[model samples]
Target: MSLPRIAVDAMGGDEGVRVMVEGAALARRRHDRFKFLLVGDEMLIKAALENHPNLRAASEILHAPETISGEEKPSQALRRAKHTSMGMAVNAVKAGHAGAAVSGGNTGALMAISKLALRTMPGIDRPALAALLPTLGDNDVIMLDLGANTECDARNLVQFAIMGAAYSRIVTDLDSPRVRLLNIGTEENKGTESLRDAANQLKLAAQGLELTFDGFTEADKICRGDVDVVVSDGFSGNIALKAVEGTARFVGDLLKRAFTSSLRSKLGFLVSRPATELLRGHLDPNNHNGAVFLGLNGIVVKSHGSASALGVANAVHVTARLLEENLIERISGDLAKLGGHGLGNGRAAKGAAAKDAAE
Candidate 1:
């Protein structure tokens, strides 16, 4: 099925135009239906496209002289949104020139631009950063609020669960995904009032929403594969994400050291090379490269700044899948099911209160 073209921030990543163009080319090769609006310096994009005639034929270049640097702050980036490649790419989505936008630039900048351009979807108070983490089971687990809102209230958590589950359904193809809140412990009375309240609300609303409300899961169990969605405040979720990444690195480094420790160990490594290769492939970040900003009116996927062509392709694939699955509509449907369940007015009222306080 041919879908709408995806807008790529061609000058966003570490390698800039070459890698981004190559990645989009790679995606086009995998899915012939994929088309692109490559936003960057026209000369650089044209030069890069020389290597991939297929992409050149299928893509259109939008000249964007400015690029958002990795170190640029969101506020500063927002000021130049219309002029920068990152912002233009997002603007393409908002303007209906593209189905979704993908960027490997500054996450904060991309988030800010996307939120400003697309705005939050109806019934969503805040947009959360959600990503798929590799797990021990057949499917990867979805985790949200990675570093979006540092402190989320119970209402935000509930909204995150709704969004995460909608995403999980698209990615995992599960009818009713198992959803859980990340907490200090699994006990009913263990967490903060917000956690307890969100859990209570989820339990009450799960049946109507088509989600399996599994009370709580601790950090260590996030990738165990028992649950499909893990929700948390950005502070805790970001820390847990880093911890998981650190542990993966630690294991890889330890294995490398052990294998090279002695000649005998090197011989053993050769014998176990196939098994280790499989493990390495499974743990590679490239295999899971996209992080979606859920709750936005339009889709915006964040690719790792250092991601390779393969990683960028994966991010594009993710954007395509979400578009095909109608993720925003699904979330809206679920939210509609919660009518009279106390969530209908909570987000709006909360926003109003916050606005009044600011005034």
Candidate 2:
């Protein structure tokens, strides 16, 4: 099969065009069939490509004079969608010129523009931010609604579960992934009505699902290697994700202080350098830089705004993999089993009926 070409926003990321271009080169080396449509200022992009001869051979450039700044509001960014590099890259996918679009630009802007240009997939009310997180198991776990919808109903949560499970299957190479809902406790009745309703519905739909619905899982146990996908509302999922990242940085900093506190501690650190290096590799966010906007008509992978060259490459790798696996098709198949009802429609209608009976 012919490889798909990716549209990249060359002016995105904290490190600018150099990192994006170099990353493309690295990805090209690894996946020789991968092609690039680098969109940004042609002169600068060309200069950066001079250092990467291989990438220059496999890539083409599209000039986009403007760039969306990280601090710009989504509304403000949308107005410039026609002229910005991020916007053009996303438009490339909508135009069918590229299979996917990758960017390390403003998260809110990227989400806003992508939805406007590509729209949501059929039967999907909204798209969720699905990201790969490190787990103690051999494979990574997929988490969703990281910051998309702060408030979700029972049906919305159920949709996230389905989307997340589909993503897990592709990334982890698993036949049947084990999914769990993130909650304060694992008991059946511990959460709100929405959580309870979603859980019941998942159980009802489990017979038709290709994945195993493992009920509820606590936040502390998400990385225990037992769960393959963790679903939650954007409010809670975002908090949990941030807390985990902060804790990792905290521990690393504390260890650095202890190791340098004295000669004895420094000697001990030297003795355990190999083990620490392995741990660092596992915890490095760069190894897992891509966060996909699932449920969109076209694939859009969001890279960390502060990503390095290798980090951007990893994001590109994720985009290619999703396209190869036909992620959107897989999600559509699972959604079809839920009937033609839109997200949350069943539960909403039921609630209205109950109110009528009470009145």
Candidate 3:
């Protein structure tokens, strides 16, 4: 098979064309099988490419006259998408010119354009924003619906579980990842009606599904590295993710302060430098920089706006892995096994109504 080509929004990130081009070159060095479609102002992309001879050799530039600003609303961005760098990059995926698209542009704009251009897959009503988070386990955990749909029904939650599990299989190399619904407590009746409903449905289909639906998981237990995938509506998922990010930063900062408190502390820090460096490498967001828009027909990865070249390369690496694994096909197959009674097919609602009537 031919190497997959990734479409890049060279002007999207805070670091602009230079960082994007350098990142692509770094990614190419890691995976020689990858090719890139650099979409942005030709003049700028060319100038950046001059610094990366290998990237220039492996890339094809497509000039986009305009670029989307971070402050632009999704509505306004959609209207001007055709003329924007982010838009052109996404269009490349829709046009089948690129297997995947990666951008560090405005999150809302990227989501809007991806949905409009590639559309959602057959079984998913909405695409979920998923990211790989560091865990204590042998592999990182895959969490979904990070910020796509703020409010989701039971069916939507179920869909997220399926999508998250499929992603885990590819990225973590787990045959049957342990999937869980995020809840306030582990009790079966602890969460909202939607959470309970989704859990019941997952249990009913667990034996046939590709993943192991391990019931409810709490936010605190998420980083313990036991669970493989965590599924939640965007509202809770986003809050939980932010809390985790904040806590990580706080701890890191505290450690730095403690180490610099005095000469003795600084000596201790020097002695433990190797261990601290290892910990830092594991916790670095740049190592896992891709937040994928799952359930879309085509692959789209949202890189952090402030990400470094290494982060950009990691995001591109994620796109390559998704393309190589055929993640969408796996997700579609899993959804298919649920049959007509699956989530988003009125089955969950009908069952819920019957239960309510009985009560």
Candidate 4:
């Protein structure tokens, strides 16, 4: 296999260069074709790599000499920390030095710097960061804009759905994925004027992209697997995502304590080894390591702020798959049919409700 290059923002996470080095090493250990360009302070990176000499052979260090703090405001930090590792790493991909970039830095700063450095593809007014939300069934549900676009209009939402659907098609290979608007209720005309307007535009985007949209879906329906793509403004999507994560972790702890009590239950757990393994693997947060900021020029993965070495490693692996698949090109090509013209209002074919009432 041909080698693909990835740039790591060595100063992004709290662990700093140490975790980044370990994550890059983990990727190299798994795939010989994976080469990394570690961008960070020259001295700190060198010292960290001395402790893990194995990384030196497969990864090369790019001296950034500055770091972007997690607390710094996005747009401001990008200007102040012009020489930060995150900025340099983004430049690496923009300059063709890497195929993808991964950072656990301030998400806003990363987004701003990346957009300024690489710019958006033509016809894309705004880029969105897509996230994977854990669902009950086999595969994860795709949610976005993940705080990328806060005040999205109907047109922006339509474009976001198009990008998201392309991602699901390539990543999960779902045939005719169900796209739904995240709303207060499943009933038609249930949300704000913005949501109703967005839903109508979604129908237009769907028609242009040849995607299947199932209309408005309540938050409770996320796990039913009836919808593969859930579209919402970033503010609401992030809240629902965090709430679900907290709930899942709380339930997991409860299950662990329940199984450890008494000899009888312990024996039953031993008998149910396969079942337990299935649940643990499916529910394990580490498996879902990185969230890709889609529609950017190159793949940029934002890992969890508290991610461990294992989580970082999984992120590198995901970056590799995304690059190999050429996800951006696929998305742009598929959605080209979706012109930026105004999408007609999407009411339920008008007055069909009155006809049915008369019947």
Candidate 5:
């Protein structure tokens, strides 16, 4: 049997080894292919493992000896801790001992480590972070550039759309899921110079989609599921993602307070328990799992820094599915098609020339 390994950055998160171990244990329960290579302090990992009464034998530990904290600069962290927990995790993915990596650590450090280790896919110049966003409506949207690249060009936006579409297909099972540019307005002239150019490019790349194209949309339309793939620059995308997250937390807390306000309200809460739980599950960041750093040579997932054990476990679960789908190669094929024919009716020929110029 082929062994499917995931390197866990044990020293990377706020929860310490305990939650990391618990997350790994949870993953082991979900998939037999999961072989966790825990990278951190040996003594700490052992203690966490001891807490698990029935720890899986598949788990292995690798000592980091050093760690990168949340506040450190990515460059500084990389220079200081080439052998840190995050660095070791990246090395494991690059060395092919693990099919994927999941880390709840410094976002910038994780991205820097991944780029240095895994590099970018051949046709992809930059690797963008994509977060799965749940909608109040039926289908959820996959939003990209959650903060990988601070500045992106029209070409980059086009790439994000293609990557998002490919991901939506293999994982979300939406063949040609609708693509929409995240804009301040829905008109063709909306957004920055890059976005305006990107919109026109999308028109030329019409057949590139697995589904038909939907136009530009505002942030509010996100919760409405107006489109399947939402493409935006990293700065704006990060702001939107955090805004939604903050709002979700605020509303959730308010609801909790309301539920226990008085005897009458408490009775009302029981009646709404099932629906309320459903809403909570949908809004929970843990259930949303980690964000994917797509367009890489291999899988490198960036779990939330504040993620709990359940969040880590969910990250592992989705990552396993990504491996089963052979996402790297899958993306290559689809993207190669875009490089040649699909988008905007063979705009790839023009796109290729532009890509060459950009280089």
Candidate 6:
């Protein structure tokens, strides 16, 4: 089936127009139905597109006079949201010219521009950043609130779980995904008041929401693959994400050093080359490149700044899948189910009242 065209910030990533255009071209090759609204310098994009005739035929360029810098603060980038490549790409989504927007630029700037333009969807308190992480099981785990809101309340956590589960269903094709909150321990009473409260709320609302609430999962178990969704506040989620990434790097580096230690080790490396290659492919961030902003009125995917052409294609592919699956409408349907049980409204109000009193 033909999908809506994606708006790509062609000047956002480190390599700028060349890599972005190539990535979009690669994605188009993989899925011929995909079309693009390339936002950046017209001449640069056109030049880059020369090598990829298929993409050039399927894409349209929206010239952007400025670009947001990686070093710029979110507040600073927000001020220039009119003419910047990242901003205009997001604007295309809001204007109904594109179904989604993809960027490899500043995370804070992308988030700021997306929120201001698309705003949060109905029944959502705050939008969360959700991404798929490699896991030992057959399917990757979906983790949310990765550096979006530094702190989150019980209501926020519950909403994130709902959104994450909706996303999981799309990617994993699971009717009911197992959901859990990230906590210090798996025990119900082990975390903060917010964690505990969110856990309780999820348990009550899970039946109607088409999710199986599995209480809490520790940071160490995030990629175990048993749970489908892991919810957390952005501060803790970001830290945990970094720790996992660091561990992957450490393991990869250690293997490299071991393989080069001696002639015998070199022979052993040759013997284990297939397994090592599999490991490398599994851990490569490009394999799981897209981080989506959930609960927004429109789709906006964030690609890693250092992503290669393959990574950009993966991000674009993810955006296409979400659009095809009607992610926003799925989340809205789940939220309506949660509201049907009265859990979202009642618990959120109580949580707010408790916070106000505590303050």
Task: Give each model a TM-score.
Answer: 0.95, 0.94, 0.95, 0.85, 0.91, 0.97
Quickly count the clashes in candidate 2. 0
Per-residue alpha-carbon lDDT of candidate 2 for residues 1-359, written as tens digits (9 for 90 to 100): 88678999999899999999988888778778888999999999999999999999999999999999999999999999999999999999999989899999999999999999999988787789988889898988888889988877776778888889889999888888998888989999898777777787787776677688999999898777889999998888898888888998999999999999999999999999999999998999989999999989999999998888999999998898888889999999988876544323466535633543454
Between prediction 1 and prediction 4, the one with superior lDDT is: 1
Question: Which ten contiguous residues of candidate 1 have the minimum total lDDT?
Answer: 348-357
Ordered from best to worst TM-score, the candidate numbers read: 6, 3, 1, 2, 5, 4
Number of the candidate with higher TM-score, 4 or 5:
5
Residues 1-359, model 1: lDDT tens digits: 56888999999999888888888888888778878899999999999999999999999999998999999999999999999999999999999999899999999999989999999999888999999899999899999999999887777888999999999999999999999999999999998777887887788778888789999999999999999999999989999998999999998999999999999999999999999999998999989999999999999999999999999999988998998889989999998887656554655435533543454
Q: What is the lDDT of residue 23 in candidate 1?
A: 87
lDDT of 6 at 320: 87
- For model 3, what is the alpha-carbon lDDT of residue 124? 86
lDDT of 4: 0.77
Sort by lDDT, top down from the best: 6, 3, 1, 2, 5, 4
lDDT of 6 by residue, 1-359 (tens): 56788999999988788988888999888778878999999999999999999999999999999999999999999999999999999999999999999999999999999999999999898999999899999999999999999988888899999999999999999999999999998876798888887887888889898789999998989898899999999999999999999999998899899899999999999998999899899999999999999999999999999999999999998898899899999999999888888777775646653783485
Where is model 3 more than 4 Å wrong at Cα? 340-346, 349-359
Clash totals, every prediction: 0, 0, 0, 0, 6, 0
Residue 191 displacement in candidate 5 (angstroms) = 1.2
Q: Which ranges of candidate 4 are over 4 A from the true structure?
A: 1-4, 29-31, 47-55, 208-210, 256-277, 340-359
Which numbered prediction scores highest in lDDT against the true structure? Answer: 6
RMSD of each: 2.7, 2.7, 2.3, 5.7, 2.9, 1.3
**Candidate 4 residue lDDT tens string, 195-230:** 776676666567656469889888888877767888
lDDT of the candidates, in the order given = 0.90, 0.88, 0.91, 0.77, 0.81, 0.92
- Highest-TM-score candidate: 6
lDDT: the better of candidates 1 and 2:
1
Model 6, TM vs. native: 0.97
lDDT of 1 at 157: 89
